[model samples]
Target: MDTEKYVPGISVDSNGHPSEIGIEITPEAFKNLETDNSKTVPPDGETIVVPLQLKATELTPFDHIGLNWNPHGHEPAGVFDVPHFDIHFYMISAEEQLAIPAWSPETDAAFNNYPPIGYMPADYFTPPGPATAEPQMGKHWLPGNLGAYLPFSKIMIYGSYNGKFIFVEPMITLDYLLSDVDFSANYSQPEHFEKAGNYPTKYNIYHDAVSGNTYVTLSDFVARN
Candidate 1:
């Protein structure tokens, strides 16, 4: 997968703090996506890790970005079984993310150790059971009152590990990415932060007709104590 085709970048304020972070997906990159699930990681997915530019790494808490392509989304059956991409802006290093253990009886304690009450977004909740925690990734927190019967398209997700916020994710379906419409929305914020840094309050997805590229950006950063 031509890693260079997917560029991760950041915009900073006058003081050098990150104001926006995003990924630029070239037209060829999206058009040539691997749709065969057999070629992906076990279950049905392919993950491409892109290191943030040096400037971005120095200014923001995130170290890298992970683009996971799901040909046939895993688990929860009807809810997320469609083809989509899970964009993860990871605060942890690539090595640390890889060391995360898969869910099992032995690793139950590690995965179940939920973050303190104000650490996660106000309305997000970790689904019950050990299956909620994924290997090489972490546990996913979904909106408390999501309409289960509705079709899955796009949504912002929060990821945590061992009681700490590790990554911010935006899940977008393949069909949506192919559409002409653009999307921008404010995501819910947590009452407290474990790490002090500028955090994004909104996300955007748009297609540039001239460049024939798709941009997924996180903006409106607000400093937190």
Candidate 2:
């Protein structure tokens, strides 16, 4: 019997419509985890413990945002230390983010060891450049899905690397359609961000409802004028 196929699940739409999708889990994958874990798992199915010493030396982006915005104002930026933050990314499909393959020792050995790609220091964010200029950064994690009208709406599990979990939550609302120029200007000025008196401390993830593709950015909050 094929263990991967499960009953279809329903995802509700904004207008109260329900759509069916197969949210599946292979029985053996979890049952035999120790023998067939992916590259992400360390030897004992335990994550490698990054040292507390490193936390004293470097403050992650989430650390900075929380320190600056935390309700109690208890922690100073770059002062208190943490191991990880719960960061979620919106993805177009489960395969796009993590493609599970046929279990094999060979494939397990090839798990990617690339340091989390697309990280930029707080100092690199500048006045937005021309509309045609290359974006300031690359793929990254965020505090949440961070956009509206996300067609896929599937949230990827949180991830951490090198003792850092970046986070940026735009205060912008998604009530209106976004134009190319308007989108660019939002990145340039980011009124909501300015009003909040915080820098774009993390990044954003957006899904193209039409094309069904997912994208990441440090700017472009789909908010009001």
Candidate 3:
């Protein structure tokens, strides 16, 4: 697939600070996705990782974005086992992200190293069990009682490693993206930020009729320390 069709962009405020960052997906690009699960190695699943460079200096703290496509979803089964996308707005560099070791006895401490109390959002917590941390990604924190009972569709996630927040994520199902309705929702915010910068307080998913494109956007930036 021509990954270039998936464009990553940023919108800035009057003060020259980044107000929004998003990815634009053309209608044709969505239809031509890979769906074979067996082809991918274990742990990673049938996933495609697309790295995004927004070329905006105002987007400090956040180095780039990682657009991950899970064709058959992932683990902690029955909850996120369907097709979906994990969009990671990473504050760390791609090199640092890739340097994360695979989950194992030797790397248990690293994967399980979570952020401090006030750094995490009030409502978000790690899924119960033997560390749901992913290699090269870090631990995922979800909001509310999301389990086998609640049907998976779309949700916001926060990621951290070694007591520092690294990424802001929006996990959306393939079904939801294919639908016609536009979506906008407020995501939870941490009591305090680990790094001083502009952070998105809200996220949105909308379809452009004229351009025939889909946009998953993060906006409503607020400066924090």
> For residues 31-52, what per-residue lDDT tens digits would candidate 2 score against the true structure?
2323222332333212111111
Q: Is candidate 1 or candidate 2 better by TM-score?
A: 1
How does candidate 2 score on lDDT? 0.24
List all candidate RMSDs to the true structure: 1.9, 19.3, 2.7
Model 2 misplaced regions, further than 4 Å:
1-81, 99-138, 141-225
lDDT of each: 0.83, 0.24, 0.77
| Ranking of predictions according to lDDT | 1, 3, 2
C-alpha TM-scores of all predictions:
0.93, 0.18, 0.89
In the range 148-214, model 1's lDDT, one tens digit per residue, is 4258888888898887788999998989888857998899999998878778899999988998888
Alpha-carbon RMSD, candidate 1: 1.9
Estimate, for each residue in 45-99, the C-alpha lDDT of model 3 and write its tens digit. 4223456555453565667667777878887688888888888888888888878
Best by lDDT: 1
Query: What TM-score should be assigned to candidate 2?
Result: 0.18
Over 4 Å off, model 1: 40-43
